[model samples]
Target: MGAVRKRSSADRPPSSDRGRRIRRSERVPDESGGTGMRRPIWTALAGFLLLAGCAGGEAASDGQGRPDYGEIKSMVKDILQTEDGKKAIQETIKNDAVKQELLFNQEEIKRAVVQALTSEQGKKTLRTTLEEPKWAATVAKAMQKENERLLRALMKDPEYQAMLLDVMKGPDFEKMLLDLMKSPPYRKQMQQAIQDAFESPLMQEKLYAMIEKAVESALKPGQKEKGGEKEKGGEKSEEGGEGGGK
Candidate 1:
């Protein structure tokens, strides 16, 4: 076998050396050089960060912006002033269910009113108002009208008339009347009424005629007996006197 010749550095394969050099040169640099193939990635990352920062700034600005309360209030006022809004509110209030609820709560409302009026302060206020002459007069006139209306209504009710008649005919009512008649004040009033009636000329003439008739009736029989006795006594007395003279 022939002795192999020593391989020299210059005799090394060009392909292997070239491949190693190419690999070394192809290694990505770190911060020492511009990104070559990664340029688009870096650019994309940078652009994303910038956009994020812009978005953060916009959010910060939105957070710092205050609401326009005055404008909001104006808008609300305008809405309320609209005809549709008014109609909606009116319709809600005029609902049949609302009316029924109000009717059902009427007793509660009346109780509340009675409770309030019965309170000391309410009573005092009412008294003060009623003490005013104008208020009192107005109340009196209203009460008079109410009483007249009630009287008219009662007069038109046959049942009410029957009830009244029954009450008047009742023993309790008779007792009440008898008690009133027995009272001293009632007796005085009745006597005064009688005296007033007798003061009339017609009553006085009737009374005088009744007394004259009563007196004539009482004296007629006695007058006849007395006349007969007087005639007999006078005749006897004449006869006695003639005898005495002889």
Candidate 2:
């Protein structure tokens, strides 16, 4: 019987290696920049208020405190549904910089970010009962609402709306997202890309150079030892026998 053929590279599952080559590139980490918290200040502030308020209540003493999840969800839903909220979002989409980004890299940017936010692993860290979860469900729900809001806002920005519809329907959307994940730049975002990219290009370059220098210095001794081992192995073969005795 003929041996079973192995799956060709193209036929195999997508590579574990994902990058920011296409649409997802913006999401990737740029170690060249300073690392800081990627979370929005308002989110951090609200969390502080939530924890402080909770600490004063009976729920705080429970084995697991019940989150004011309904309140949070309502806030999120309100933000997305209200007229002023929608107007602010539309304004964001209308900003020249944001418009350029949306129009130029809309397809890739959306796919990478949405894929990262909605991925099984991404959602896992974001899951848990609201009682025990630290802003988990709230965060997820807010993101979902925000994305929905953005898509609706896109309708007003005809170029971006067209781009989104082009890539976000049926199988094309799934493939685009999967492609975004496998692309290097985007997967980096899942780790901590946003914080790093929020800086000037020159500063980012300097930071990366420092990191590279540190890594090289740390590895220099180990690399020398490996080089010595290889040299010793070469000498041993020369002192022993040549291949085919020639």
Candidate 3:
């Protein structure tokens, strides 16, 4: 008879050295995980696999004394679906190391998001969503405060100031202003503003004072105009050259 062939790494069951190591770790602490959580989970898995593989190692063997991968996967899935599995997952997530790992992945998530938004499919989806008036309105309302804050911050930026000045100084802006000024609505608004100004008591007093000053100024100009009598009825003053009062 041929010598009994020694088992290779590929022939060994998952419950071999792995199962024993898992069992050993359960008695000690797992500093990396903040608790011995990983050990217990692994120990449970190893014990299950050991049961299926240890008896002559033939019952759950894929072909020759090795546990089947498909069976292992199905078993893991069934285990994960249990309530205890969910609780274990939640506890594991509470670990500081896990939180740091999640935070560290944020930059990658951001890049993925940007790439998605820039893609054609994402653009089409965005356009469809925005076309819904209710959605558009809700988004606008939600973003209003943020938009205002961003604008306020931008207003303080020197680059933004320069860009705004450049735009206002452009020929297109000048044309736009001229067109706005020429519009009937703009003329109507201007007339309405003038009427409102006249109706205001302060504006009325200011206008009245301006008119009185203008009258006095006109009279002074007239008095200094000619050295001889200019009015129909003239009285020449010997003290100084002056125009006759109208």
Candidate 4:
């Protein structure tokens, strides 16, 4: 009123300023909830969305992604079902080196077999089997046939027979026989056998027959006349001695 003020811009608030302040205050009310509680809820919701996005990104990556087990299994199954894969497996097992190793271990296998057969249980089983009549008979028959066949084959070999004869005729064999006969035990056995034979009744009868034949032969011809003269002389001497005594 004093200066009839021209109402310059600096003397009063602009109408636009009032409108802006009112809009700001209204916007703040809309953003905030009762006691401003919606602030934390909105912040937590934003953080959860950020983490979900990161997890989704990681799941989509190639190297760090989850494994596709079904795909891997299918691939493995396909490879194993192929002909080449089967052939490779078979060749590994049937390799020449494996065959050679088995061949080289044959002696070890034989030793293992001998050890097993020589064990106490094995001996007991063998004894039981041999004690069984049927089993023993069968084994004996087989062994006998084998022995007979071997003997026949050996007898058919002329070289073997010659070797046997040579051995029998060797000086070593003659020395062995002479040594046996010279042994004191052998001499005693032979003497006992001879004495037993001479003590037999048939030997005594034969000896008596031989003695009677010898006496008959000695008494023949001039030998019998000389025997009768000696007997008559002996009887005269006996009669002379008896008369002198009377």
The lDDT for every candidate, in the order shown, is 0.91, 0.76, 0.85, 0.88
lDDT, residue 32, candidate 1: 58
Expressed as tens digits, the lDDT of each residue in 93-147 for candidate 3 is 9999999999999999999989988999999989999999999999999999999
lDDT of 4: 0.88
| Residue 133 miss distance in model 1 (angstroms) | 15
Could you say which candidate leads in TM-score? 3
Pairing residues by index, what is the TM-score of model 1? 0.33
What local lDDT does model 3 show for residue 18?
A: 85
Runs off by more than 4 Å, candidate 2: 1-67, 109-246
Instruction: Put the candidates in lDDT order, highest first.
Output: 1, 4, 3, 2
User: What residue runs in model 3 are displaced by over 4 Å at the alpha carbon?
Assistant: 1-113, 124-135, 192-201, 223-228, 231-246
TM-score of 4: 0.23
Q: Model 2 over residues 1-246: C-alpha lDDT tens digits?
A: 133344454465554444334435665556664223454566899999998898867555673465678888999998999999999999998899998877899789889879977999767754544446557667667799788987788789989977878777869789978999998888887656656664769778988999999999999999999999999999988877865486
What lDDT tens digits, residue by residue, belong to model 4 across residues 10-122? 58788998999988887665543653777788999999999999988877795456778999999988988999989987887699998898799999999988987899998
Number of backbone collisions per candidate: 0, 11, 0, 0
Clashes (candidate 3): 0
Q: Write down the TM-score for model 2.
A: 0.19
User: Which runs in model 1 stand beyond 4 Å of their true positions?
Assistant: 1-142, 145-161, 224-246
Q: lDDT by residue for model 1 over 1-246, one digit each (tens)?
A: 122344564466789788998888778566656566488788999999999999999988886697678888999889889999899889988999998999999999999999989999989989999999999999988799888999999989999999999999999999999999999999999999999999999999999999999999999999999999999999999999999999
